[model samples]
Target: MKIGDTYFSADVETDGPIPGPYSMLSFALVYAGQYDGQTFEKPSKYDQIFYREIKPISENYEVEALNINQLDRERLQREGASPKDAMNDAWDWVMSLAGETKPVLAAYPVSFDWTWLYWYFIAFSDKGSPFGYSRCFDIKTAVSIKANLPFSSAGRSKLPDWLQPEREHTHFAVDDAIEQAEIFAKIAEWKA
Candidate 1:
């Protein structure tokens, strides 16, 4: 149930799917609740996780979602959060609320976010991961199977125009985490 003090949900942005070549741009965690056997609650979650956008490190490139974040490299280089500092801070924050035991890290695409974030941070921080947990759950995959959501190529375009800001939507890693949190609140049980 209680790990140390809190439960955490992780949000991650990656260069692309798969590991190694694809780097973790940034990540965030919401310590809303902790794993009690197998239950989660909305204790309190942050609206923002805020992390710098980094260049996508990839070997096999697919233009499929190249500009998903749509951030300028120059700007990112100037304002990027070093992988070491970012993960250390996030993990510390997650663990601070959790007990010594590892907490569940719920994410949209648990596999992609968890592995990418775990590997990237372990290597970058070189401190190894203090968040000792074995299982990572994928909300997206789970939701897709359960909700039967149809695939659609249209993303923002499918969204209302009023929702679209003139400037590119904040591509910072944390911003994405916030969005996912909101969606989860509405769907409750996860949907693709």
Candidate 2:
């Protein structure tokens, strides 16, 4: 691992309640211990983390998630790529990370992001996922069970021994990825 580098957290931000037929918009990767939540950051440094905004089919749109993005129109005009194109990019990114022992995807809400990505991969590739992995590790669930707390506990906990000093603004992709990373680090640190 290089010093002063982002920790290659894989993430996909979308405009929907669940990630299925919905378009993926505004993908980002943040460097841990670099810019992270401490400063303004963008997706220029993660060598293995790739992201793309895709135009979703009609069945993919979810009104609630669309409002969360707050950039549906702007993204459509600028960053929007076809679903196939974005999927291809993401698939390549996964292949690049094949070096990892278990080929992990760390995310806060794995149920949502993992499912959405799987659907897109199958649809885009016209086959099963190219990554050849069947399971994903949910960092949030790890943290929750490790500390024996609820998902909301992360927002309220403040003890460093329990967690890494309580991170804030953990809904967006980068921040959530960081949260997941924190849990992974702790798990590794304690040899759990």
Candidate 3:
């Protein structure tokens, strides 16, 4: 990879609360833009995007989770892409957009998304994880720090009007990803 770093806003919809035991139904990545270790910039339009729906690895799932993502489990079983293929394609797209810059995965709550993503990448892709083990950004933590609020208060409702996006946070992977990407940029560029 390159010497610099790029921030990739990522989101995933899963059938359950955890990886291994659950299945990731869909995932999306939005290359918000590069962060030169000091400054942040928004991408021009919808420049970088990656999205996929994967076949379930297990029969187990939660109805609430499915409802949240608005995905049809039966349809996914019949038409979803292979996990290995999807992960490979995702890695390729991330790499192409990153160029020489190291890709840094960012999520609203990194723990949940990172768990599924890292596990899937390692479990399915021979290329291993594109973001490696340590490169990750947590929007919640960043916003909490920037806003000088306690971590528990960093939820969306606590954010100021300027930081929150107007888009509805529909659980569709790509739409939520784009929404989170905007929030990430705002916090990253925030002076306070």
Which one wins on TM-score? 3
- Report the number of clashing residue pairs per model: 11, 3, 1
Q: Which stretches of candidate 2 lie over 4 Å from their true place?
A: 1-8, 28-48, 59-63, 77-79, 130-133, 150-162, 165-172
lDDT of candidate 1? 0.53
| TM values, all candidates | 0.64, 0.66, 0.96
Report the C-alpha lDDT of model 3 over 65-174, residue by residue, as the tens digit: 98888898899999999999999998898889888889999998888889999999999986888999878999999988888889999987678888988587888888
Model 3: lowest-lDDT 10 consecutive positions:
38-47
Question: What is the C-alpha lDDT profile of model 1 across 111-148, one tens digit per residue?
Answer: 66778767866776555665554555555544444445
By TM-score, the better pick of 1 and 3 is 3
Q: In angstroms, how far off is 32's CA in candidate 1?
A: 3.6
Clashes of 2: 3
